[model samples]
Every structure is written in C-alpha cells, then in structure tokens.
Target: MKRFSFIALAKLPIGLQWAVLAGGGGLAGYALHQTGLPAALLLGPLAVAICMGVAGTRIRVPRLMFRSGQGIVGLMVAKSVTLGVLLALSEDWYLMLLVTAITLLISAGVGLGLACFSSIPADASAWGTAPGAASAMIAMAEENGSDGRLVACMQYVRVVCVVMLGAWISHLFVGAGDTHLPPIAAELPFTWIGLGMSLAIAFLGALSGNLLPAGALLTTVILGSALQLTGWLDITLNGTLVTLAYGVIGSYIGLRFDRATVKHVARLIPVIVAANVVLILLCSALAWPLSYLFGKDFLSVFLATSPGGLDAMAIIAVETGSDASFVVALQTLRLIGVVLTGSFCAHLIMKWNARVSR
Candidate 1:
C-alpha cells in the first residue's frame, strides 16, 4: 500500500500530486468526519504539507503546492455571494456597515498587539499576522517587511485556534436554541465528467499564470463558486477535497515555521495564544451587542466575531447549522472590509514601529 501510494504520488504532476495528497486526505477525513476527529479540517492540509516539505527538500517543484491550494479560498468567498444573499443585505446595508467597521477595528487591534508584544519585527508581524488570508497576509508582510515565518506561523496558528475555539464558543454561548450542526450533505453520487470538469477549471485558473497576490486558492474558490452559482458548472467538493484544502493550507503554514521562527513561536506561544484568546473573547462579547443592535441572533454576531477567513468561517457557520444567509452575509461584508482596510492598518503599524525604533 505504501509503495502503491508512493508510485501514484510520483507519477502525477507536482501540482496534482499536492492536490491529491490534500484532497485525498480530505476524502479520508470525510469518511471519518462522523467520528468527530479533533481538528478534522486541519489534518489533511498538514499531511500534504509535510509530504511536500519532504519532497521539496529533495527536489524543487515550481509553483506546485502554492498555486494548487491557493485558489480554494477565492472559490469559497464566491459562495457567499448568491443573489438572495446580496438582495437581502442590500436592504440591511446600514447594519452590515457597522459590523464591518467593528470587525476591522478588532482585527487591527489584534495586529497591533502582536506587533507590540512579540519579538516579531513590528510591521511584518502586524501585517503578516493579520488574520484574513494567509497568502494575502504573507505577501503583504513581505512587501511591508514582516517576517514571512512569523507572519505565516501567527496567521495559521490563530486560524487553527480560532476555528476550534469558535465552535466551542458557539456551543458555549448558544443558549437554549443552540444545536449541533447538521451533517454535511454527503458527496453527490460521483460522476467522472463532473469531477474532471471541476478540477479542470481549477487547473485552468492556475494556468492563467496571474499572480493574484492574495492567493490562487482564493481566486479559484471565487471562480469555482461563481461557476457553481451561475449553473455553468457544479461541484460537490468531497471531504477529501475539503480535507486536502485544509491540509495544504495547514502544512504550508507549518513548513513556514522553520527552526528559528519555531523557537520564537515557542517563547511567544503564550503571547500569541493570549492574543487569540483575547480576540475571540472580545469578538464574541462584541458579537452579542451587535446581534442585539442589528436585530440578528447571537450566532450571527458569533460568525462576525469569529476571525477565520470568509471561506473557513463560512464553512464552520454552515457546518454548525448557523443561518447560511446570515453567515454568508456577515462574512462577505467582513471580507470586503478587510481588503479595504487591512493595508491601511498595516501601514499604521509600520509607522508606529518606525517611531519606536527611533
């Protein structure tokens, strides 16, 4: 079995190989999802990333793993923009605007905290640790002088913590009506053509060779979701695919934490962990008030407060049986908010850093 798996992995293109590993693990995860695996989502991505790290150390693959999983995020964001979701929010624009502002402020605060407390050079830590998109934050960190290792570690560690914690928090605060999330819709009976086409579009998106700075997974996620929404194509991304996405993302993150940064991480784990805890607590507290003000339920506030990316948060929202429309609505608004304000805040942190340096 090991030999066969190795041979299978060796025969595939580098990109597909990574995808298979990630996606394959996701599938395996899906199979066992019912068992309530701890950190089920992260397992696949970590596995693939570890494999890729081993392989890349041995032989380089140009834009292999990076491009393959990058687009998954964008595809996830597009899922939040169905016509119904758009129209409903159009009527509630004022409340969304408020929530967006609040979310941005909290994100900025957390970024600033990381800058001040950790040994991470302030600017890169601030931007790279920004908790929206890993690739986007890392790119911004690089451009802004953030340590990629610090930024990647901080961003992903927070993601892992936030997802697990968010769910626990939801359960914590759910009150009487809070219920465990329904099972994900099982993979629609398989069709080779459909699967091929779904992957084909993702591959084509990668082939576009555009450097979508935020990340290709997000780009492809957006494109693929758009296609799905428009009825031009349909994909029931199986657990394997989903797990693969998580694993690629997770492993990419773990690999980013080479020895030096790992050391920093160990020393600063308490600080980073505290930051995540504080952010989550504050966000959840803020969510309650906002939910009342917006005339939405607490879960909506929870979704808003939950700092996972639009895609990851959205999936959790859906998985936990939160109102899909509300989840999508809140996440979409937050995504737009982050894109517009994240850089400005990073700049602000940088300016502050320079002042301190002087």
Candidate 2:
C-alpha cells in the first residue's frame, strides 16, 4: 500500500486527478460549511488543494479559469456598491483619506521591518504584507517583478487569520447578531438573463489584462458597480458559481506550491503570520476610534478596517450582522487606496533595500 492515498493516485490520468480534487474539495467544503466557519467553502478547498500540492499533485488550474473566477468574485463584491455608499465615500473623503494613509504607512512599516530582518525580497515583502484585496495584491506583486507565489501564500495566511478573528469578535460581542441580508433570489428561482449578463460582463472584464494588473477583477468590479448603480445590471451569483470561483482560485494558488517553495518558505511562515497578526491588531485599534467618531458599532467599524480582502470581510460582516454598507464602503475605499499605492510602495521599498545593501 502507498504511504498516502494521494501518492498512490499520483500516476493516474490528469482527468482522474482533477476528479479527486473536486471530490475531496466538495466533501471538505460541505463539512466546513456545516461548521459555519467563515469562508468555509473557499478555505475547505484550499486546505485540500494545499495538501495535494504538497504531495506533488501534477494538475494545475488553468490561468483562464482562475481569471474567470476572479472576475466572478469582483462582480460579487460589486453587488455591495450602491448610490448611498458612493455618497458616503464622497462625504467622508477626507476621513477616508486619513485612515487609508494610516493603514498603508503601518503596513509598509511592517513590510520594511520584515524585509530588513528576513530572507524575503523587498518588493515581495511589501506586496505580501500589504492590506488590500488579496488577489489584487498578488497580481500587482507579479506585475512588479515580485515572487507572486509567495505573495499569494502570504495573503492567504493573513486572510485566514483576519477572518477567524473578525468572526470571533462578531460572535463574542453581539449575541445573536442581526443581519438584514435579503435572499439573493427572493423574486425567482434564478435569473438566467441576469446570470448571462453577469458572465458576459465578467468575460469582457477579463480582457482588461493589458491595461491593469488583476484587470479581470478590478474591471469587473468597476463595470458591475456602475451598471448595478444604474439599475441596468443584475448580478445573479449563487452558491454554486461562488464555490466554483473559490475552487479555481484555491487550486490555482495551491498548485503553485511545491517542495522547493515549501522549503524556501517554511521558516518564513511564522514571521509572516506574526506580521499579519500585528497588522490586524493595528487595524482593529484604528477601528475603535473610528467607531466612536463615526457613531457606529465597534464590530462594524472593526470589520470595515480589517485587512482581509473585500470578499472574505464581506462574509464576516454578514455573519456578524455588522453594518454591511459601512463595511463595504470602507473596504472598497481601502482597496482603491492599496491598489493605487501598491506599485509606488514596492518601488520605494526596493530602492531602500538597494541603498541599504550598498
């Protein structure tokens, strides 16, 4: 008998290998969902995929599928955008600027410390430690000549930590949290027209690769938000679509892992996790003052300022019954801030590192 079931199946046809992944991921996702963990479906597939990758699974998710998944997630997040959210952003532009600047500086400082003290490169460190849409950060990192695979790993670790902490805080403070989320399909079983439009838009967004890093995602978000605000677009993303997206993303990242990558990053994981924890704590601390100043509940504000991606934070916010709009607005604001500043920050850090070495 093979030492591991995965090892025994290593020589199977790639199609069968993928079948194994799908079966394992589905079972794991269902189990985790039943446990009510935050980002359960995504995390469950991720857990299995990581194990498969570590076992030297030869299959890899196609880049197109991964990009499509990103596009879908972008649309999902765009569903949160509304006219009132835009007005709120405009009204509190200065406050938004202040918090965004503070968050970036703190994150950059942490990245710099990690780069100076660790084996990771300066650009990779900056992108890895950045607080923004995790996928966006990873894409930008790759575009800027950083080790994107490592950045993806870093971002995932931070996301898991942030989600767990946010969920715990939400459950602890608010007994029987109050969520006002309407059913995704309160009107019909499903909107085929809406779903088709969404897919068409997402496919169009994926074509934005030449214009932007993570273009598939950001473009879809921008286009979807605009159309949604105009009442001309109906995004009909359901659990199955969402699960497929998550699976694609999870598998893509997981397949990037291998023995060499694992060994290279093994020692770095601990410090990377610590840095993420520190950033989360800092963001939470900022959230407290912002909560009082804005006359909002701490959970809402805390979630608003969290370092996780908009998708994961969205899950936590809905679960905790936090003020969904406020969280989305701030999260959207921060994502823009991070995306805008990501390249400049990486360049600055690289320069500093070069100077230090000389």
lDDT of 1 by residue, 207-231 (tens): 6535544335445655776787788
Write out the backbone clash pairs for model 2: none
Q: Model 2, range 180-264, lDDT digits (tens) per residue?
A: 2222434335778998999998888878844665567668878998998889988786767777877776666566665557766
Candidate with top lDDT is: 2
How do all models score by TM-score? 0.70, 0.82
Task: Report how far residue 27 has shifted in candidate 1, in Å.
Answer: 11
Name the runs in model 2 displaced over 4 angstroms.
5-9, 121-123, 133-152, 163-183, 187-189, 315-329, 347-358
**Candidate-wise lDDT, in order:** 0.59, 0.75
Query: How much is 49 displaced in model 2, in angstroms?
Result: 1.3
